[model samples]
Target: PALRSIVNPDDARFLNPPDMPKAIQAFCRETRQPAPRTEGELVRCAYESLALKYREVLGWLEELTGNCIEVIHIVGGGSQSAILNQFTADACQRPVVAGPVEATAMGNLLVQVRASGELATLAEMREVIRKSSKVAVFKPGPAAAWEDAATRFAGLRRGN
Candidate 1:
């Protein structure tokens, strides 16, 4: 994940932070927990938390779609997180594909290309993605523990 409020997009933040590892460290300090100083630990915390939130969102998506999700595609700067992608696969119990870190621009370009008749169909767009960009595919792993972590995480949030 990256910084938000960059003039075009604005979004909001804590422990198990979705972004800002520094903020996560601060939260840990406030709670008398050891701060995550290493990159791996900080990233892990963020991934785990983000995975839980994504699972929650998927629950709503299922309600809207009225079916089980088949696959997930994560595109953007945040998609660069292998840890996050793996966690998403595990927690969401679905395959997660991440790629084209600059997907915003690429997707915009594709829309323009399609408008110009250079491409057609969403399937064709994805084929372009496969041939033209590097993607990381993550399969779901054991997620039983994530539920407990998520519950504790929710408690931390409720205290706020």
Candidate 2:
């Protein structure tokens, strides 16, 4: 969380574009800041960038669907990262539900159980999963800072 205060997602130095070498060099030059040298810095940068990107994409999805996304459900191995989950919640201003780390295996088992006629519908299967799995919920934090960061992130996307 301390890193979130210092790391600006709008700063292109945090972004890992497809052409990484060229992009990092250009971003560092443009921002007049040294590139991330330590492992922790690099990891935090990546997490912040990813969280901002998620917020951006969620906006696009909401526009396309004409529906508000209340909560983000993150499964699989990625759900295990409390830091990333909290970052996502903060950046997106939405609750993040992360759990069922062994999602693939659980999904396969659920499908088999469903095929056996024990579960009558998809909702029933979902209920079973929800009841059986342990989940962590991260609610969004204070929005003022994140809102400012989001504005900068949007400007960055627009080539400002």
Q: Top TM-score: which candidate number? A: 2
lDDT of 1 by residue, 62-86 (tens): 9999998889999999888887798
TM-score of 1: 0.71
Highest lDDT among the candidates is held by which one? 2
Q: Could you tell me the TM-score of candidate 2? A: 0.79
Stretches of candidate 2 off by over 4 Å are 1-26, 31-34
